[model samples]
Target chain A: LAKTTQPISMDSYEGQEVNITCSHNNIATNDYITWYQQFPSQGPRFIIQGYKTKVTNEVASLFIPADRKSSTLSLPRVSLSDTAVYYCLVGAPHRYGGATNKLIFGTGTLLAVQP
Target chain B: DAGVTQSPTHLIKTRGQQVTLRCSPKSGHDTVSWYQQALGQGPQFIFQYYEEEERQRGNFPDRFSGHQFPNYSSELNVNALLLGDSALYLCASSASWSGPQHFGDGTRLSIL
Candidate 1:
């Protein structure tokens, strides 16, 4: 498993775009970048995931570079409801023998969306 | 469809006591994983159970044990608890080991 680093906090205004970056210098070939959003008193919700290049979903977009050392989660036109802690994790999807892939989480980036 | 569900949203315990937390995986899910989250910190993996067997474990101690039933529901048992054990325990479920995990709100355990 590779260790990840992310910003402790970020600020955004309503209807603005917010980008949170995470760095994983020792990412393995099988590893993928996953971003999760957690609201207060709630479990983390899956946001976006990517291996290399770019991947987009209805909620967010993930951009990975050729090096795969880092990833950026982009949230477009943010709202107050989007204020939450965003976590960046790096891990393989699964191991052999049907063993599950355990998620490794960092302190995460606290996105404070102000009205 | 209902997502992952956990039991006893809040609990209080003292030193050397034992506590059990329950979790029901999402519909059609077979794999369950447990995590512990301290205040202002990221969740840490405890272990994962599949097919009524312990498949993977984290850096947790033997005091932290788990059981998975045939229905894919799971229980997390912690014995001889310490104040440091106080945290929000989260349960996540996935259709398979390769699928994305869905998490429950977690059971908040406070150790005095």
Candidate 2:
């Protein structure tokens, strides 16, 4: 598993675009970058995941560079409801066993959305 | 469809006590994993269970144990708990080990 470094906190106004970058300088070849959102008392929700280049979903977009040492989660037209803690995680995709499901979470970046 | 579900949303315990947290995996899911999240910190992996067996574990001590039933539901047990054991324990389940995991709101345990 690789260690991830990211901002402790970020702030953005409503309807603005917010990008949170996470750096995993020692990312492994089998590691994938996954982002999750957590509210005050709820479990973290999967936002987006990507290996390289970019991946987009209805809720967010994940961008990765060729080096794969980092990833950025982009949230477009954010709202007050989007205010939550965003976590970036790295893990190897499962091939045939259940051990690959273990994920290490860091002190994720807390995104505060201003109304 | 119902997602992952956990039990006893909030609990309070004292030192040297034992606590058990329950979890029901999502529909059609077979694998369950447990995590612990302290205040102002990220969730830490505890272990994962599949097919009624312990398949993988993290850096957690032996005091923390788990069991999986035939129905894929699981239970996390912490024995002789200490004050440091207080945290939000999360349960996540996936259709398979290769699938994306879905998490429950977690059981907040406060060990005094």
Judging by lDDT against the true structure, name the best candidate: 1
Candidate 2 DockQ score?
0.67
Number of the predicted model whose TM-score against the real structure is largest = 1
Docking class of 2: medium
Which segments of candidate 2 are over 4 A away from where they belong?
none
Model 1 DockQ class: medium
- Tell how far residue B1 is off in model 1, in angstroms: 1.0
Q: Against the hidden reference, what TM-scores do the models get?
A: 0.96, 0.96
State the lDDT of candidate 2 residue by residue for B1-112, as single tens digits: 9999999999999999999999999898888999999998899999998888888899999999999999999999999999999999999998765657789999999998
Cα lDDT of model 1 by residue, A30-53, tens digit: 898999999977899988878999
Which residue pairs does candidate 1 place in steric collision? Answer: none
Fnat scores for every prediction = 0.66, 0.65
Each model's C-alpha lDDT?
0.93, 0.91
TM-score for model 1? 0.96
TM-score of 2: 0.96
